[model samples]
Target: MIFRNLNWTKNGLNINGENLNHLRFADDLILFSEDARTLEIMLQQLSDESVKAGLTMNPTKTKIMTNSQQIAHNELIIVNSEQLEYVKEYIYLGQLISTDGSMNKEIERRITNT
Candidate 1:
């Protein structure tokens, strides 16, 4: 349901010639972008559209992650007037995703869990 009426292709992350902007599994969703401002726009657009459907969003449960060292500080990504949280790493679907863009942490986590 994200990016219902916005042009997100221009801002999506490209890897190995494939552009990826979001990943969705049932109700769980993850959005990706190279720039923080563009991401903010996407979230805003999603928020506006969700309102029309009478669906409310929970900003507290939302999270923002990035691989840049500068991180997110310029403009706060607020949906429903609430700023989202930023983290160094978060688990998605069953794999550990880190802002460092490395698989080492996931490997270690799996090893420890096993």
Candidate 2:
């Protein structure tokens, strides 16, 4: 999701499928999917979108985690040092709360979506 004042002039990434969720505020984009294959495809599409938008997805800053028990190391959240579990809130200053109270005013101010 986009944050701060960074300009995301490029077009946002668009993926098609059922039960897929995507959030884009500026350059910061977050997506979620239930199916494994769909998630994989979405990531691929994200890479393409990054290229097309002239935005670079920093490999070192990116993290991919799987929730399935069979999937090893399923706890990383890309571009963020904090664990996925810690991201239970996304505070948006002066805005309505969204999704499980993740939208905290302090958190939104701290969120630096480059």
Candidate 3:
């Protein structure tokens, strides 16, 4: 609900019908796809849209993590580029979403504790 000007599109993929969206963000842009191929398509679409809108997609700031295990706040667990078995985690927004499917229970508890 942050980027009120951006549009929303239907993502025609499902893994157990979880609550999901193709793209979600407020001031910054966060895009999601069902798979790697779909993610590629989405990225291309983003590039095209940006071009048409006179906006720019910062490749330096843009990051792609394929085969995502799960997405909580916005972070991702992505396999390392150099190592196949190595996985890395990142945080997006203010929540911790892990590839292992863990939620920020402690943060939620703290918020409610007050």
Per-prediction CA RMSD (Å): 2.6, 10.0, 7.8
Give candidate 2's error at residue 81 in angstroms.
Answer: 21
Predicted structure 3: lDDT: 0.50
In order of listing, the candidates' clash counts read: 0, 10, 0
User: Where does candidate 2 stray beyond 4 Å?
Assistant: 1-20, 65-114
Descending-lDDT candidate ranking: 1, 3, 2
Writing each residue's lDDT as its tens digit, candidate 2 over 14-103 gives 345333356666555565655444545555556656666676666544444333454344434333223323222333333433444444
Candidate 1, pairs of clashing residues: none
Per-residue C-alpha lDDT of model 3 across residues 1-114, encoded as one tens digit per residue = 223333434543555765244545554655666655455555666566666778766654566554445433244323222111223444567554455555676477558878
Each candidate's TM vs. the true structure?
A: 0.77, 0.41, 0.51
Residue runs of model 3 more than 4 Å from their true location after superposition: 1-12, 15-20, 66-87, 104-114
What is the total number of backbone clashes in candidate 1? 0
Best-first order by TM-score: 1, 3, 2
